[model samples]
Target chain A: MSQGPVRKILLFVDGSEECITAAQYAVVLARTLGAELAALYVVNVSVLNELFKARIFIKMEQMDYEHDLEQDGRRYLNYISELGRAKGVSIETHIEKGVVNEVVVEKARILGADLLAMGELEPIKSRSDAFHDESELILRKAHCSVLVVKDADYIERLYQAME
Target chain B: MRISGLLSEKTISRLTRTDKQGVIEELLDLAMNSGQVHDREEALRAILAREALMSTGLEKGIAVPHAKTRAVSEITMALGVSEGGVDFHSADGKPSYIFFFLLAPENAAGPNVQVLAQIARLTHDRSFCEDLRKAESPAGMLAVINDAE
Candidate 1:
């Protein structure tokens, strides 16, 4: 079998259950392909800006909300990093503050990543309809190949087998 | 209500170094001299370890290199301005001119995160960043931060 040309992989994670499932697959792929892995968690600044403009949160309160979101991003990135470590796949973690799709694509390009991996999209609520949805936008505009994992159970099973 | 309250004149200065490690070291030295950080070596190690995990260089010529460690008693912040941009490996592929080095207690994650978010929000404005770059002295930098708030 000819070896794949993938040398670097970038994974976008948002701490969702589905994202965790996708992260498991990313780890396995990185280990199998001997590729360097990087995980990114964007703080979704555009959504926060909308909430601020809508006066849903006062200035001080908005700062607090942004802080909570960043903490969440850090936790999720750290979790993925740990998972990658356990499987002998070193994963670098990044916490970017910006629009989700834009940041993901920009980071991928900057890292010279060969492939971008993300979880399948969850149902969007009404409140999120106002902004550009990240999943579809990332798929359509990514500069590199993209892998969207839809089968959470299958990935989870593979992850468990590695333990 | 302004984040500038966290920064003192002594904690702000111009960075002469053109590399990320040297810049971080200089900022950490400033934090130590200000008596905000108890152990300089430990704080430097912690910050570098975090940097190794990910470059904190954001877009728009700004880099917020931060770490939550027990080396500091509180959330300590130091600002460095580099006239000749340093290679921070920012996502935009541009050199970073403004550097914010932050050290916080492990238990103060909430406030630490808030300070980072506040810095990000403030620097997102191109005008504000321009003013920050023009400020030549530590007091000038503080004034820019205060005026922006």
Candidate 2:
């Protein structure tokens, strides 16, 4: 069954407080548009490698942190699924390991998403900060329409209003 | 997810049980107080069935008895410390001093796997396990977990 302009929504989450809010918004949007929803979590392995090169973490510590981050990504993705489940929206979940923005863009492209939903971007303190921010990079790189979710209270109410 | 949020003073205990079955019961009782469990008997059966397949004992004084069943509303966890040590048929053939009991909804396979991984990582740090075992009260034990996260 075809909905409106949106058919599939790919939600990119990174275990952030805002991602939970974004997930809520995505669930509500999916239900309203009758669109399929998939939540993606990237392990951001490159950041760990950067830390290792910076001498902030030794080999063992880097491996351990990498393991923890992978687990965290799975946990966050599962959380989004449960949120969708509660609203009677079946959500698919995916976890990948790579640079966060690159992985998200690749997954969205592969999934052929009609909309790419993400948490509110962090305040860009400078052009360099914006250049380095993964969320901003995702917004710039995605081929589909992007939805940067905000207003946690409003999203919560919308989610709660759903059956 | 913060491990601390899933646990509290109400969901932790200094186990009075000295045996494996006794300790499981004690932990389940603590889980009941969390108000997340839907069916106590089903949860217990699921845990025991998991034990029937293999022991959750991961060595180094830690035993993580867990299950995924419809009996839990979400992923619920209860922790216990056995000062005298309980024999859990650990991989290392050693007594288990700390127990991390986890119950998840049957459909929550992904989260269950992640929680198990997180527990494995926590158990890898002997000092963290030791701190939890040395904790005098549930609050103290909770503090150790909060600090580790």
Candidate 3:
């Protein structure tokens, strides 16, 4: 009941180490199934920008700093994606403006992805899946299976299993 | 380094603040006073509201209080180590001692995925959590965290 051979995986990242860990795990899957990978970064809206702008002089100087941050985010995503790209994994990035949880689901649907790999929070989520906390939410909303990743060492496991 | 990262001082506080609400308020105040957040009350409300939707406490005595907003410019983080664990109403029912309060711009959602991924990596390490628990003060805790990074 799925299109093609489940060869496309969507990954959501937030410039955190867990995100890089999730990306590492995703590369293993992409390599195994020859799946394409897409990394997404969402900058959850800043309350500081709104309140400060409303009450005081909206400093272009400070706002410029914010713009630079967005660039840094893109660079971080690019660096992570480069790893997958080296492994012959088709990797791409998308930066959108919105909330984290909501946008995560939205991007998955739009990508027509077969699987979503997220870093898992163990002891609560399987030490192998990050979305263990919100798997139900993402699983219920997305038209795909969400595999929350636990750690990069699992990639060794994936490779060993493949061998 | 991004200014957000600087907010994570290499310090550990042997604070004894008990419970979730108390920690939340204390952390919010610290975040505000440090200028980590623009509106103290508003950010607190957002964190509380997010908690209502679901506890930010994932596991391993780690609770990440995060909110997606259109109010800030970039993704900012504030971390605290409470000697006593705080009840996060986690789905798995665990007390989280390490707290990471994250702030993102109103139009920032993609960063959340990356941020979560990074956190997972940090949390999977037993040594990291063990050291956090062993921290004597806030500066010490931050030092350990920064050293890990």
Candidate 4:
């Protein structure tokens, strides 16, 4: 029973439901294929830029906000690692401070990951829609195989059965 | 950004759904009816698609289900409190009682993430969650949020 050629899997999580779902998929894929799993959380410094430029949030508040975001990143990374552990999968976690798309792609390349798993791209209204710009960039530029995991419909069906 | 500014009296409700997908659909429908979301079907699809990727169930009985999509013209929010918690496949393996549904314009990552972070911060406070849970009505929920802010 050959498990394909996947050796290393990189998962990008951001505490979103989609990210969490992707993490689950990554864990299963890793366990089934006997691949090493690594999760990355980018702090999204771009948000800080806007927070500072707008001066909407005071400096102290901004500091507190940034700290909270970092804490969130760490928490999510830990959660994913714990998920991996519970599933008997060895998972490596990376918490970095940078732009989301670039950081993910760079880390995936550096780790020589064979697959990059993430959530589905948000729907665009027209040709100019830019909702999932980071995802778009990663999909186009990543060296490894990109998997956009979406399972809402399946989940809905499961819940409907319960109803 | 003030958390209260993102939420309104109309957006807060007592959730009746006991399942994750039902709760999400109910909240998104509320946002759509409020005219914040431009397209209900598209928004629902995008949010659900995002959910399939991950469970937004955070610890402390809170879940933040969010999506950035072309279905919304702006960042919109709907907060639903369920007395009977719904199973959300949380990392903590606990049911989620408080649900924050957020829909944002495809390009507005800044506000979208900011609101999600704000909701997460609020949920971290045990007292705040308690206050929210104890809220008698939508107005009560808004009051708790305003006081916390």
The digit string of per-residue lDDT tens for model 4 on A1-163 reads 2257998899988777788778877877787788889999888776665544432233553565567667878888988887778778788999887777889999999998989999887664322234335677888889888999888666334323431
RMSD (Å) per prediction: 15.2, 10.2, 13.6, 17.6
Residue B83 of candidate 2: its Cα lDDT? 90
Q: Candidate 3 at A70: error in angstroms?
A: 15
lDDT of 2 by residue, B1-149 (tens): 35677898999999999988989999999999999998999999999987876777766788888777889879999999999899998778999999999998855544454455556556678899989999999999999987776
- TM-scores of the candidates in the order shown: 0.51, 0.59, 0.47, 0.50
Span of ten consecutive residues with least summed lDDT in model 2 chain A: A49-58
TM-score of chain A, all candidates: 0.91, 0.94, 0.70, 0.82
Higher-scoring candidate on DockQ, 2 or 3: 3
Q: How far off is residue A130 in model 2, in Å?
A: 20
Query: TM-score winner among the candidates?
Result: 2
List model 3 lDDT by residue over B91-114, tens digit each: 468777877667666555444434
* Structure candidate 2, residue pairs in collision: none
CAPRI band of model 2? incorrect
In model 2 chain B, the worst 10-residue window by lDDT is B108-117
Query: What is the TM-score (0 to 1) of candidate 3?
Result: 0.47
Two-chain complex of model 1, DockQ on C-alpha atoms against the true structure: 0.02
User: Which one wins by TM-score: 1 or 2?
Assistant: 2
Give the residue spans of candidate 1 off by over 4 A. Answer: A1-3, A124-131, B1-149
Better structure of 3 and 4 per lDDT: 4
Global lDDT of each candidate: 0.80, 0.82, 0.64, 0.77
For model 3, the superposed segments whose C-alpha errors exceed 4 Å read A1-163, B1-6, B10-14
lDDT of 1 by residue, B1-149 (tens): 24687889988999998888899999998777668788888999998887776677777788888776789888888999999899998767899999888888875544554466567667778998999999979999999988776
Best by lDDT, which number?
A: 2
Candidate 4 has an lDDT of 0.77
Candidate 4 clashing pairs? Answer: A17-B54, A18-B53, A18-B54, A20-B54, A21-B53, A21-B54, A22-B53, A131-B106, A151-B52
